[model samples]
Target: MPLPDIKPGRLSACQYADNFSDAHPPLTHVQALIEAERCYYCFDAPCINACPTGIDIPSFIRRISEDNLRGAAKAILEANVFGGMCARVCPTEVLCEQACVRNTNEDKPVEIGLLQRHATDAYFGSPGAPMFKRAESTGKRVAVVGAGPAGLSCAHRAAMLGHEVTLFESRTKPGGLNEYGLASYKTVDGFAQKEIEWLLSVGGIEIRYGQSLGQQVVLNGLQAQYDAVFLGIGLGGVNALGLASETAPGVGNAIEFIAGLRQAGDYATVPVGRRVVVIGGGMTAVDAAVQSRKLGAQEVTIVYRRDQPRMPASNYEQEWAQHNGVTIRTWSVLKALDTTLGHVQGATFAEVHDINGRLEMTGKHWELAADNVLKAIGQTLLLADPTATTLALRSGRIAVDDEGRTSWEKVWAGGDCSFGGRDLTVEAVEHGKIAAYSIDRALGFARHDTASKRTRPTPA
Candidate 1:
């Protein structure tokens, strides 16, 4: 039994810089113009219908075609405040671009995501006043918990509607998963922080960091003081692999590893094993495996219990991992970890098959050598004593209506912590936006005509 060989400086400085560079570079002006023109601008665009945030796809593309970059950005930002980040991280291949009409005649769908990045990046790169201004103060205060996409989106919308907002974030910085969970290559050059600063520019929104629910702030206190409360506290609990060797030194949560890589100032100093094994099929698993390879891991493997089609991550993401020299082994369920001196040396997995409609494990088993194992099965809601809030839970998540209203009055929830919809960032933004409007109506404020005018299309 010996300690696992895990240390930093595995990759050279130049390799680190190259490995972590932006995954998709922004398009030039000429390139954007050419791409925008490719859009047929269908009368009833299916692309818009497919988007979770319901951005006006054809209209924005038309604006870009006309050289109206500001208007295009306004169209995108007004629909989803975090459109820029979504453009970078969202799986447009299966969402918007999948529904694109051009995909029929031309195998290539219009680069809607790249065009979006072009427009939004243009606006943020230029010197101009903020897109929206705060309305006359309503004198009513609102307390928002969580600084992730949902919370930030809610805070921005509430502030724009003339409510004073106190955004409470448990973490030291805002942006929630955007700041912490994403792969370093997807969001480069601290874009998450930059977007946060831009979002806070609308005024009337004050951020209080290090304020977590149940500890520094409580639901009862917020209810008593603020006019309303919105909870976007995203899932904070990681699901375990349920193996005895999970406690091995080389085994860790994939989310924690991604967060550590995101926060590291020196990429070369971030320790990574020579051979890494990630277990799960979601984007988090793919991200961890790909980034491990980028960090100079000689071999990286993603083992998913189910078949590839059943994986939560899109096909595009799966292919991206394969292209990055990571291996995908499906229909394999982790059985146990082979550890040496409290360090993971390898993992044993059992073959799985779908019998009728049920998944059953076969007696056949195999093992793969690995110095590190990452568990990315899923995340669970981290509530601070559920009884204290008295909000009804459905399947271990906060139950909310179409308007993002919880069972309890004056308290609302959205994002991954709430039931309904996919856990995509764009979907979370829509939840926050809808919840803010609902909160406004509950407070008896005259609904801003713009709010109704910019309504999102119902999810299909």
Candidate 2:
């Protein structure tokens, strides 16, 4: 009854600064050169294949070694418009760095992610002519829904190919997860918006904030006005514990908590519990638990149903949470919430066993005392909305072809909202890029020959 012990100023200003400061600092000029020289510049770079966007890793690193940060960043942004954000948030340990030829026991990886940040930071710090140049106007218009990474990537690509793009975003600011869902320490100094500004400098694209799909912006209206439509509206439904009536004060979703923390004016003003228990094992779960600790939570535990190796969060992320004093309680699923006076008091977890890839709950259960319990199980596509009835779905998401063509010929979907998506920011950027090129081809605008023109064609 004492308001659940959630209060502001849990930590001093100095503690807040140190806790939320940049998780990975940028490389100095000499350090960038030293690291860049580590790359062998393979003729067939495995890092490029491992990358979702297929960035020219060797070329960029070579440019970095030559002290051409501008050229290096141009090479990166050409492939991925969100190069800076991806450099910070992407799990290089499992992706590019893992594929590095130099990632041997004898020698460490070339620090590709940091070198990338070095190049992008240099370009962003010193403004110059836009890296991207728009092609001749095709006079075709495209509608891009969601201003997150996928939507922004699609809009930027479509615009660069000379198609007018109208991007619709539900939130006040763009960058979707990059701006709202990412951990604060990862992307410090408002870098998300800075990258977006550089991406927009390519021209021929307009962003309409507060315009969400299935609401202010509808597919039927978009289809009628635009030659093609791209939907990157990410998953909107957060999964919950099977236990019903678990809703109570001091209990909430981890994504919501993260968004609040990202937007908070000051970390000291953010409310946190003395004890926090996070549900799930993916990136969001770790982010929630770790950030809770940073917010001065005395104790934080991550409750996951699966074993440690089976956790969706990368090894680096799990180690990060553990290093920050968060206890990883594996093979435990939330059975129920212990509430007092309509507020959460603690949680009950049932031990689970993996029997041939299936989680079987054991008869035994245990309890953990906590005031804040955050749900980070997973996210589901927003199909409950009546507006999405016309869209055919697969595996609980919007179905799309290799080129991002949806069931509707004129409509293309990508990012977390579509099936076959890897749920990685880099992969989402690839989806948008592929969809834009496909849309351009359908519009009869040849990339090589702008003189050719034909009406939008129906899918074969």
Per model, how many backbone clashes are there?
Answer: 0, 0
Residue 87 displacement (Å), model 1: 0.8
TM-score attained by model 2:
0.95
- Ten residues in sequence with the least summed lDDT for candidate 2: 449-458
Model 2 C-alpha lDDT per residue in residues 3-118, reported as the tens digit of each score: 68777798889999999999889899999999998899998899987788878999999999999889999899888888999999899988899999887743578798999999
Report the number of backbone clashes for model 2: 0
What lDDT does the true structure give each of the candidates? 0.90, 0.88
- TM-score for each model: 0.97, 0.95
For candidate 1, write residues 1-460 as lDDT tens digits: 5668788999889999999999889899999999999999998899997888889989999999999999999999999999999999989998999999899999999999999999999888893976898889999899999999999999999999999999999989999999999999999989999998999999989999999888888888888889999999999999998877798799999999999999999998889999999999999999999999999999999999888898888999999999999999999999989886678899999998999988798889999999999999999998994334577887888988778888877988889899886789998898888888989998998584434543434433
